[model samples]
Target: MKIAKLAFGLICLAILASNVVTMSRWSEARGVYDDICYLRQAHLFQRLGLGGLNTNAALDYDGYFEGKMKQIAFAEWQDPIRWPCHNPMPSGKDVMQYPPGTGFLLALFPEGHQVAPLYIAASLIVCGLALSGIAMARTLPSLVGAGLFGALAVYLMINPAKASYSVAPTMAVCAVAGFLTALWLTREKRSVLLIALIGLLLGASVNFRLPNALLAAGYAIYLAVAFLRMRTLSAFAQGLGFAAAVLVGMAPTLLAQAVNAGSPLATTYGSADVVAPAFDLAVLGQYVRDMQFVLIVLAIGSTAWLLRVGQGSVRQVALVVAGNLVVNLGFFLSHPIFTPYYIVPIAMLSLWSTSFARLMQPEQVRQAASLGREPTSLGVPSR
Candidate 1:
């Protein structure tokens, strides 16, 4: 087992090194409208600090936005009204349509050299988590599974993740959240701190991509059902704490919305994004034909396997993952747009949670038995 673990760890490290090389060669000016808008948000933070949250077009006095547009030969580069991702607000202010978190992350690095470092840092974090997962595996099969999944997860940082600037950070969040989900659900004693941290991560993810808000659907449903079933103050408190933490985590986005859109609840997105959800067969077919479909199937299969063979906390984690997959898939499948990275977040989250749940199952079962509460196949106490 030790040798096998070491082998997998080395494999994961090799993948990380390759990812770093690929990311280092990336250029921020890819002629993508979204890329410029995201970088503009970063430029705002670098120039104005917290004041950057107000992304009014008038603040582009330095012509950074114009310069980026011109680099791509955009015809209306000088007209803020004609900007690609900026939306016109009712208050007559034009604001970048994206949430501020990605920009905030980019601002951590120096300007003109941001995208490569951002991706590298994110990939490193993912590689670290992959190594941790491998270390936690006790058996050969678990060790192999962790290593393979970890390698795949790290490799994805460059493929679909490279598809969007928002995706890199979002993937890191999902990986962390997945590990936390396993830890929180499997423990014999519940930890409010763990739950809150998970909520905060999920909430922060929304700042990277709006659709990431749907990532919390499974947790919400699970907590609600648990509280309803127990009718206990502890359960209710858990739910309340999670929701509050999520709000706290997403506070920056709310503040950005308030500053740009005149109301915290108002969105800065254009009409195309704010449309009602409708199932388009074409969109569904696109997903079915994409690599993301493979991930979705894997997540579903893992969830079912865990539910079938797992007991105690493992089963609970499976239930949450199952609920999450359903909600996230439902939303993405119905939406009119299809992006390569759209469904990747939820799939990765489910896989990470399921993987950890399996790796930790033996320890959890032993702990439950020691507490005189042997878990039945249905995940309830045998007594």
Candidate 2:
């Protein structure tokens, strides 16, 4: 399976690489905002370490409407620097509101446009690896589902206007991919130790983008519910172990924030005026109404499917999907505007369902053939 997986992975990588190269060379929207700026931020951090935050940082409160503020401003996507006062720009340095993790990630690239292709390809690969991990985790055959996920990820990567790349969606992709990989690791029963390692990595996911907190929480909730169903003391220990691992990972960032800016959640990317106390309740109410309509349909469909397909690991997929639904609900209850990137948590649920669909495939043609003659129809109901 490893050999087959590698072969499939390489083939997929080649296709993606070619696509990225083509996009790089031929696309009219080269060196655009998100494509250039986000990559520039990653490149800056990867090469310069934390010190790079000093270069062209934007205020977080400016929000997303103020337009491209600066190099680092583009990094955090903060249009307005949310500050204690209306004018938060106290010093020459802009707010580095984004977590240090992405800066650290950005550090890995060569500074400037020289390595743009490498940077874009790397992002594409991260996305590909994420999709591949999700497909593989559900015990799905690589030959079938894995390719589609990679292709979809690549397609998504290519189609976005240049501006979209530098903003929230790119970071969201990384978080989505990371969370899916983490969940896959959990499903394999790798170990609490490994899950802890993943939890620490998840800290990066959460710090780079706030929405990742939702994704991480969704996974944690899924595990909690799964353990409850199993009713094992060890399961609780595992959950604690995972949380500890996450905290262990998150500790450094928090400590850094405290030392550098006096708060764990300081806006290095600048700041935002949007306070938890001041959220537009009216807009949030509308969001909730819209989300409710969507979830109702999904719940109805999932319930119908559950009744038709008897109990098994597949049911666990439903539980994971339920966890994701809760994350979306939380988003709706608080944030007024929903972006395309916000759908990331649900994307994991889609991948989970796809994987489960693969796992439940007949062991052999003969087993499937026999099922037709038997009362059951491959464990699905006959309409």
Candidate 3:
């Protein structure tokens, strides 16, 4: 297992280096719309932390930050705040669209390594998700579960339209991080350290994106309730401990948002609470169109698999995914505008649903662990 993980890590690193080179060259030539915005945000993150960037420069959509490198050069040569070529964009100034967590994470590297960090992080996430799927597949005696996981990861990583978007990396990172944490929480019975680690990872996941944090919180609550129902006081206590760790880790980002925007929920793009019909629906429609391929297949497959593997913890996880989808869609429909990235909460759920089947306590696994597997009727395998 260690050797397989090491091999996977090496492959991910190689892919990361290649993708970084490609993205950097692409940025050098003619950067895409979001790349310009992200690179500029990267610069801002380098200069100021979350508070200053959100409060001061977020409203300047057409400021010197909108242009590629040349625009910044012109801005410096002319007026730092005013660039002759800078056009007035309706969206206004671009703050970091994601939560401060991701920006601060990217800021750890040198400016030139900006794109590389995203590439590395994204690759590592996909690899982790793949490994988790493999673990689940081992229990099935068939490749179905693992195959689905691999397909989903590839779809997320290389899909043309999604790859072009700014939030894809976040989607990948949150999905893998959430999956690993979920496995850690469930697989080991009730280990305090593992539970704490799970909570910390969940917090980190949420810090990257707000919706992810919501999803993790829901799952944590569900786990706590489950443990309490089983009368496992220790497990329940561990769940609470994990939740507290998440709160502690997430405090800074939430505080930054409140200080800067008067609302911790206010994202760099806009608010999540209000829905404007015209723009919101139009954007949602466009996003659904671009993502129709994987999204539809994943939705169908996840539902069918969950139905086949229903009851207990698997069902609980499925319910959480369904719940997140409902809530995320509601937010998208209610918002004044939709960004495809907003659908990420749903995507993360879909990935979780796909990977969680292996965590089911199959008879063989239970026997091996000396835990009683649910008995089968008529000599058939346990349902």
Quick one: ranking by TM-score, best first? 1, 3, 2
Please list the C-alpha lDDT of all candidates, in the order they appear.
Answer: 0.89, 0.48, 0.53
Which prediction has the highest TM-score against the true structure? 1
Q: Estimate, for each residue in 122-180, the C-alpha lDDT of model 3 and write its tens digit.
A: 65566566655654443333345454555455445544523433455556655655565
Which model, 2 or 3, shows the larger lDDT? 3
Question: TM-score for all predictions?
Answer: 0.95, 0.61, 0.67
lDDT of 3 at 210: 63
Error of 1 at 215 (Å): 0.6
The stretch of ten residues in a row with the least summed lDDT in candidate 1 is: 374-383
Considering lDDT, which of the candidate structures 1 and 2 is the better prediction for this target?
1
Candidate 2 C-alpha lDDT tens digits along 44-139: 455446654433444223232234334335453443333211223345443444444544554554444333454475556555554455445333
Q: Model 2 — TM-score against the truth?
A: 0.61
* Alpha-carbon deviation at 24 in model 2, angstroms: 3.2
